[model samples]
Target chain A: DAGITQSPRHKVTETGTPVTLRCHQTENHRYMYWYRQDPGHGLRLIHYSYGVKDTDKGEVSDGYSVSRSKTEDFLLTLESATSSQTSVYFCATSITSYNEQFFGPGTRLTVL
Target chain B: AQTVTQSQPEMSVQEAETVTLSCTYDTSESDYYLFWYKQPPSRQMILVIRQEAYKQQNATENRFSVNFQKAAKSFSLKISDSQLGDAAMYFCAYVNFGNEKLTFGTGTRLTIIP
Candidate 1:
């Protein structure tokens, strides 16, 4: 798991609700990323952070928001969870952009 | 944008045999990196191997080796002496130099038969 931990390994929530997933790392890597994995589609980046308070959108950023207030913590929030947002989420960290990334075990979210 | 393609949706191999999974990528940049990640039934993404575009030598780790064709824009992973534990979903990924985003392929599911 590379010193990374994601809270709420499994969660079931109703649609139109709010859900937030937390990613914490001990490696103190400068780059952190949040990705979602679904059937037929590989892991798709939802958001990433370069440094504390520095965040950027990824390919599938809709209905998702991210916040990074600390180097070791990156949070992904779904303001209004929808059925389409139900998927397994993974968090990854890297010392540098060009270096290999270390992934967390992953968090599975289900929206009904 | 860089894109990775894994042509094989599923593959199977006999125990102690070998299998090769195909992957092709499209990238305009000359400086980049390619990686193979394994996701077993546990759904944990594990780094199988990596290859730098600048390196001519293929990267290898124990039973895992890659056939990298820089000119052909192809990178394939070969697993020798296949074991049941090796059965998993393999994903090919690409990352450009100085970029933080990783583009991944759909993945190839591998099954090892005893």
Candidate 2:
């Protein structure tokens, strides 16, 4: 665990409900990323932000959206949560994309 | 597209004994980075070791070291003096230069036997 922190470490929600996860970092890194971990799938990137207000899609960005209003905060929103979206989400930060990333303790989301 | 493969689904080693986890990757890029990450029951992703494609010397971090064969596209992790705390899920990852997104393998669960 680095200086990053994720909110609502554990949550249980229902399908079709909206959910938002927050990632905060004190390292002031230039890059931040959102990823989901599930069985048989180690970790899949959902989205990433290169700089404040600059964001891009990742390999599995569908059904997910991200916002970076500041360097320390990156938000991942599920407009309509689905059972398939239930998984452990992790947030990572790095000085650059090519550099090693520091991950936070993950947030576990469960959709019923 | 870059891909990482961890052939071992589960591995067990006696306490104080050593074990090796195999990882192979496929990539067309010449410059990239390879990493071994450990996830304990706590589910925290910890960096075990990392290797730069341009570096010929193997990377070592304490009791954890990597055998990197650029030609064979193989990067394996060797853990020495196994401890109970070492038991965890190990993941192999690859990241190509110019693109920071990491591609990960399915992961191998390591069990330390007393």
The candidate scoring highest on DockQ is: 1
Query: True interface contacts reproduced by each model, as a fraction?
Result: 0.66, 0.61
- lDDT string for model 1 (B23-109, tens) is 999988999999999999998889999899999999999999999999999999999999999999999999999888999999999
Question: Predicted candidate 2: interface RMSD?
Answer: 0.9
Which tens-of-lDDT digit does each residue in B1-114 have in candidate 2? 888999999999999999999999999999999999999999988888889999999999999999999999999999999999999999999998899688889999999999
- What is the CAPRI rating of model 2's predicted complex? medium
- In the range A22-70, model 1's lDDT, one tens digit per residue, is 9999998999999999987999999999999999999999999999999
Question: What is the C-alpha local distance difference test score of candidate 2?
Answer: 0.94
